[model samples]
Target chain A: MVGSDVFRAKFFSLYLPLTLYLVFLLFPFYWMLIVSFKPTNDLFDMKFSPFWIQQFTLENYLYLFQNTDFITWLKNTLIVSIVSTILSLVCSIFIGYALARLRFPGSNFLGLGIFLAYLVPPTLLFLPLAQVISELGLNNTYWALILTYPTQLIPFASWLLMGYFRTIPKEIEESAMADGCSRIQILFRMVLPLSVPGLLSAGIFCFTLCWNEFLYALIFMSSGSMKTIPVGTVSDLIKADTLFWGALMASAVLGSFPIAFIYSFFVKHYVSGLTAGAVKG
Target chain B: MAANARLKSFSMRDFFDRERNLGIMLFMAYPFFLGIWLSLTDSMIGRAGQFIGLRNFVDLLTDTIFHQTAKNTFIYALVTVPFKAMLGLGLALILNRHMRFSSPVRAAVMMPWIVPTALSSLGWFMIFDPVFSPISWLFRNMGLISKNINFLGDPILAISSVCWANIWRGVPFFGITILAGLQSVPQELHEAAAIDGASVWHRFRHVTIPSIKGVVLIASLLSIIWTFADFQLIYILTKGGPANETHIFGTYTYQIGLQATEIGMGAAISLYMFPILAVFAILLLIYLRKEQ
Candidate 1:
């Protein structure tokens, strides 16, 4: 081990810069929280320490609840995210299992194909996807987002889960198979339980991606009442007409809160899953 | 190994085995093939979109605005990608070492990545707001400049402002992933290097970097793809404005495709990104397989 002297040197050199970077990273959330709570007067006034929420008020949330379709957007986002995440997880788990365990024909290229499919970003696909959505008669509907989202989400979650399943001992399945237990039984009874952490990680990732998607949501959902949280909040004309800064910030806070909560609480899983899925991709 | 023997006996996986290839084919069919086909047609504004045989691609190539957007996207990637890579690696190095309260500090550092970017972008845009911007207020009181900076309004600031937000949103993932990379380098090597009186910079250059070089490359390529195609941060902050100066492939495609009803050109604009991103994706896949 390095001497304590060296450790101290490392600490000194690292902390100040780390703290500065931490501040930069956390500032937006802090600012959003402060602005969300601060009264419009304190928000506008230079006298207020931009850092502090001097005149704390619920007026922004109140206005958001009372005047806008914030609740509707929230619900729409919830339904779409939940459905898409579930679909992605189921498909990803099967795909991951097939690639990891089955050793079926073309599994290698199939994995490569999934990896390549993932690289096709939504920004690139939305135009053609928009045409597809319209042709399918799914335009301006929740089904459009729910259907198209998995095209992106599955590649990520499946790749991560594939890495996960490969790490599980093949011996376990071998013994179970020798015992004459079916492969499906071995997978459902043995493998699924072991991969919960991975599943959770992939689930959170799918949920986050679904929650955060903007382009497809904007393109596919056009009606005011049909929009998910991001598209509804950003594209809607309320802020255009009134420029409701307080309500806008409040909406931002609420819009971000669910995934942010899950993300912070389960950060370990999130990081590992991301690196495993992405770096391991 | 025994499973490999027994699996051939039963073919138990035959039922679900097709899903992987099937799922992959379905996923590929739309985006890769159908998308390319869509780019070849002029499907817009209630038309059946007949095949125009690369007219859309030619139109976009010849269009000045498309040329400008491509230039801006390249410039934006150049400006943001390096800052993200360096800051991420720097923080990762710092965080990799043992320290007091390191976990919480690292957690805080990663909060921005946790927050949905579109929402957090609103928070930044608020701070960058012209009339009541906290940044402008802070700048005013510093006695450095007497004016509130038009962060999203001025062309220069708009580009840099979006870059700043993009960097803010991006750096944490790189930091955390690179930190993960840093942690993997065995302590024995560092201790041995120290015994030889290898200087800090020398040990880092020779030992630490090479150990995590794969991670750094992977992280940077990922950041490059992310930043290149990103729409949320730029769209939220600037919407390709102060007169479309900030428009990248993502936002520019949205503007022309949906707004102007020029779906074919929009598809072509998006398709232009394929070659560059495909290169990155291929490089990334090679690195990923190496990691495994």
Candidate 2:
């Protein structure tokens, strides 16, 4: 009985603070969810109780899709993210494989350079990049973002995949080569099959970064139809006269849901990918 | 027959031995080398400025805006680094224990980070709006103030408000990193310290801090770099408004480059950030090498 009481005391002491911390962290999102359901008048009430719906409505969502360019922005975001991820994967795979497997003289320098490029903040690079994009006559188009984003994405993706690729045993590739496979064939057949999880993680990272990217999209793309979700959602929704809190929150929830869903499904691998790039790099 | 066979072997060996280093170099050249070239020249989009050697640098040196931005950047880095580090550490300590629903709690804690910054900043912007602020309403109701406070209107409050938003967004990074670090520290160390009659503070100071110092350093440095270059949150919230009082280097550069159309000046300002970031990068590399 004494031991049980002691255990109970320990449990509460440890658990209470954790629960409170989580509540604090999660309150904003919960508030967003709640506000999305509330009528516009209730959003700014002083005695606003959280996590409860006095009167629930789906009008906010309906308005976001029907009354705004939310769908167009969504489509633009999807295209940009998907294309960017695929390109980054293809480039990083070739580069990572070379760095991991091939014996080139400047390979180490290239590896270090890639990491340095990754460390170079986009704030610093984006200005120069704007000039370059204009010079290519790609401004005000989705291609501008697709082209410039790789400048940032490639280095990090290559570095990450290089690390993961290095851990793959040489014997597997060597045997594949012995079995009359070309370098490209061996990579496609063996290295790629083994590195799908890493590639997926990298793809997701690229997609999320591109989806949330604001500055590049803000500067590069000017038109409403061309804007990615982050930029589009802001410019299109909130205006000088009125703030659509309900539609805004609904858009926020919907825009974030796909990535959040992807993250939840692959939580462990996602965490590992983040830690591998963040902690180690 | 022997001569022909030897010739075939030599050609086969040559095919295997030839270095195709050109492809990798060619791939990196456009982005890396071209970026450097663009930074050096005074070439703006559709505007011709002379390639006056080092004039941009000289102007950057004398510019008050640049000085203000640099100072602001450093101040931001200083304030945010410790705030996030401590908050993250606090969260990690609280969540380290085995508790019911800990996994869901952990996921909940990460929601802010997973949410897009623009969206969150917009949400925060609404909350800080003068006329409709819930915070102001709450404060007024509680008799803290007589008027609805515009948190982002005044310069001092604006800076603080941006810092608060950044801290909220950034805390999860530290929390997750430090939690991962804390989990890796064996419980045996804590048990051993307890057996030795070490107080909670002593065990934490000795075992916990030392175990996570590397992660702490890496997290802090990353936060510094990230905060130094952060443009979206501040831009969406305030847009360096109410007398340019809240302009950091990143936003200032954007305003100069994109909005004001002084591309050369913007490029110069942007380039100024590189040296500081490079110093941090070198420090990180050295620390990483030492760890290895």
How would you class the docking of model 2?
A: acceptable
Per-model CA lDDT versus the true structure: 0.81, 0.77
Highest TM-score against the true fold, candidate? 1
The per-residue C-alpha lDDT of model 2 at residue A184 equals 73
Evaluate candidate 1 and give its CAPRI docking class based on DockQ: medium
Predicted chain B of candidate 2, TM-score versus the true chain B: 0.87
- Estimate the lDDT of model 1: 0.81
The digit string of per-residue lDDT tens for model 1 on A128-216 reads 77777888899888899888899888888888998888888988888888788988798789999998889999998889889988888
Top candidate when judged by DockQ against the true structure: 1
TM-score of candidate 1 to 2 decimals: 0.94
Model 1 RMSD in Å is: 2.7
lDDT of 2 by residue, B78-187 (tens): 78789889989988887787677666666677777877898877778767889767678778878999999989999889888888888888898898899878877899
